[model samples]
Target: MEILAFIYFDPMYFVYVGPALLIAALAQWKVKSAYAHGNKYNASSGLTGAQTAQRILDAYGIGNVSIEAAKTFLGDHYDPKHKVLRLSPEVYQGRTLSSVGIAAHEVGHAIQDFKVYAPLAIRNGLVPMASIGTQFSFALIFAGIILSSWMDMPGARYIAVVGLGLFGATVVFQLINLPVEFNASSRAREILQQQGIVTAAEDKIVGKVLNAAAMTYVAATLTAILTMLYYASIVFGRRD
Candidate 1:
């Protein structure tokens, strides 16, 4: 039973990871609130997210990019691997601030792809490694602790260190991902105003939606960083 007690639930867990957890919680609320507000207001241009995306693509002279409808609400994304931009059903059809803001933001990623953005490339490369680490890093850390504590294993620290290194990949991925998301939002806001998709006053509402979404990413990155710090503190602090 003791061996199963993971470090995440331990007292040190709160000390290292609590604040970031609170930020994540707050960001989720902010996203919902902002999205709801933006959803209530229809765009003056009467263009749905799909149409807005097409206009942005055309303005940027980016052709050959496909825009498709995604099934879920707020599940929109740009798939660089497939050269596809997917907007949620609401965004694809609804003519509202929230819908167009999200659509424009995703198209920002497509724009990045056209330009061969460096961070996006780095982020894509890290996806496979991060996916693997997220699933097993904690288990490896726990096993390393149990082996050292209960079995008196000499190489337990090495195993734990390996887990820490694996965990670091997640942190690196999140850090690189931050700028990518922020830049997308920045581009979205600019083009929306330039094309008169939204008046200057209406653009503020779009900012609310985009900023709230950005905070979620910020919280995720902060959480990953704090988590890595906690793991390193425990694994290396007791070097004997």
Candidate 2:
């Protein structure tokens, strides 16, 4: 009980806990604000998400990729495995600025795939491990600490270290994701402008929507990195 209490009150733990929650809340706010603004401006192009995706793909000369409509909202994504682009129902059918901006974002992934973007490739490779890391890292760390208390050995420290390493993978992946997402948004904006798909007035709204959406990913990455640092400090700092 004493050890656990000590760990709980450890200054490093508070450091990690505070930033993680703050970043998460910021991400949520940015996502909601972007979505709302995009919906409000709506596009004059009359191009559904599906159409926008197709146009972008075609412009990039990516004839091999396929675009499909998804059933969820803001669920648009590109699957490199199948070379398919999936857009959520709202995006697939809606002709709003938000929908078009988002649609272009997915298409940007297709462009990345065609060009073999290094960051996207790295992110793809890390997805499976990161997914597992998310599930087990925290659990293992907590269990290791408890076991260490029960057995009176340093096994808890070892376990916590391993957990921290796994969680670190998640942070690395999130960092890589930041560039990929931001680049995709940049491509989307450029394509929208180049193709005259949106007028000058509408372009402003598109930029706002894309920028807001990008903030969510930035927030997520910041939170992940901060979390890794927090755990590392707790497990290792106390040893000295």
Candidate 3:
């Protein structure tokens, strides 16, 4: 099966996904660079990332969500299911602009949850299907390809089509995720400034960090789109 992946290996796949891959790499580099640079300057508020999150939630009158230190580096995320905002060690403990920016971004999700953001609700609903698609879509695709191309099996193309459809869930998830992330960052910036967590000058630095982080999501969404198109061509363009 490992060899089977290579059997269908089309250079065109790379051609289709190459720009997105480059963008993804660049976005990651930008995130690391921006984070390192922003981490050097402390926010004027003198609040740790955890504190920043708490303050933002307090301002919004959202008391139910709890903030906690996360175990991994750069693993900050909001667990909507548990109403917990988990921050990485750096974000949770540091008082830098990077820390506050990231902390507030997670808090944005909590706010979204409080407001019942429609996109967020829809995205949560798609999570299970996207997970399943990410795990098994390629295997099914390869199996279908081998059956149709090598064994000339009947109805093999249908299997590939089904795999393609499943993989679409991931693309849909990525598309839906873009607005959620952008909205969170927008909310983060606005509330951060309005609450005096970041001075106007410092807000620019926070914007840099948050914008870099948002680019990563954009890259992922682009990658998912290109990957879907690449496989669609393969499955549907097979010689009859």
Candidate 4:
């Protein structure tokens, strides 16, 4: 019963998850700073983000993909099923280092699709479970806690275990996503250099932008992992 109170106010939970929260905050700041700085410097190629994406697609002989302008800020993504690269207004029209760099990163995912990258496929497959976990995992966990702690129901702890397992899928998805994102950024940097889309010096700025963006994903992964561990410790610590 005392352990159940940790759900609302647990110093140990902070001990498990505090560093991840700090990292997430720092990663977010780094992303904003790098993006803002990169946006100020135009790529020497004089191409808009859309054109840059087209250039990369054409270079790779990947003609099936279509590029579209997205309305949301920082909403850039590659939809492999539809073969569409959606870039935010800033990345689709800005012509700055951040714009083309982000566009190229999305294009990198398109290239992964064209090449049938295994990790991307795995991540895609995990999407359903991850979605379910994101929506219901915590609800189930809290419900189990309520039942076992307040009602003393038999087998209620197993409900929490199930919830934890579901949340584990989300964790696994984030873990697999790290390589996919890093690989896409790697591809973007290489192609940007090979095609001379950015000068050697400008590529450094692009690298910072992409690396900062990757850090956000790293932070998210850490958060998910630590969160799972925190709940696991609580769930398993209780004596039924």
Best by TM-score: 4
lDDT of 3 by residue, 137-220 (tens): 988887887787778785797787888889999999999999999999999999999998899999999999999999999999
Error of 2 at 154 (Å): 1.3
Question: lDDT by residue for model 4 over 113-157, one digit each (tens)?
Answer: 999999999999999999999889998888887787788885897
The most accurate candidate by lDDT is 4
User: What's the TM-score of each model vs. the native?
Assistant: 0.95, 0.90, 0.96, 0.96
Q: Predictions ranked by TM-score, top down? A: 4, 3, 1, 2
What value does the lDDT take at residue 132 in candidate 2?
Answer: 89
Over 160-232, each residue of candidate 2 has an lDDT whose tens digit, in order, gives 8899889988998999999999999998888988887778788888888788778778778877888778666
Give all candidates' CA lDDT scores.
Answer: 0.91, 0.83, 0.92, 0.92
Give residue 43's error in model 1 in angstroms. 0.9
The superposed Cα distance between candidate 4 and the true structure at residue 162, in angstroms, equals 0.5
Native-to-model Cα distance after best TM-score fit, residue 137 in candidate 2, in Å: 1.2
Q: Which ranges in model 3 have alpha carbons more than 4 Å from their true place? A: 1-9
After the best TM-score superposition of candidate 3, give how far the Cα of residue 118 lies from its true spot, in angstroms.
Answer: 0.4
- Candidate 2 Cα lDDT to native: 0.83
Cα deviation of 81, candidate 2, in Å: 0.9
Superposed on all Cα atoms, model 3 deviates from the true structure by an RMSD in Å of 2.0
User: How much is 83 displaced in model 3, in angstroms?
Assistant: 0.3
Off by over 4 Å in 4: 1-4
Can you tell me which runs of candidate 2 are displaced by over 4 Å?
Answer: 3-14
Candidate 3 lDDT trough over 10 residues, lowest sum? 1-10
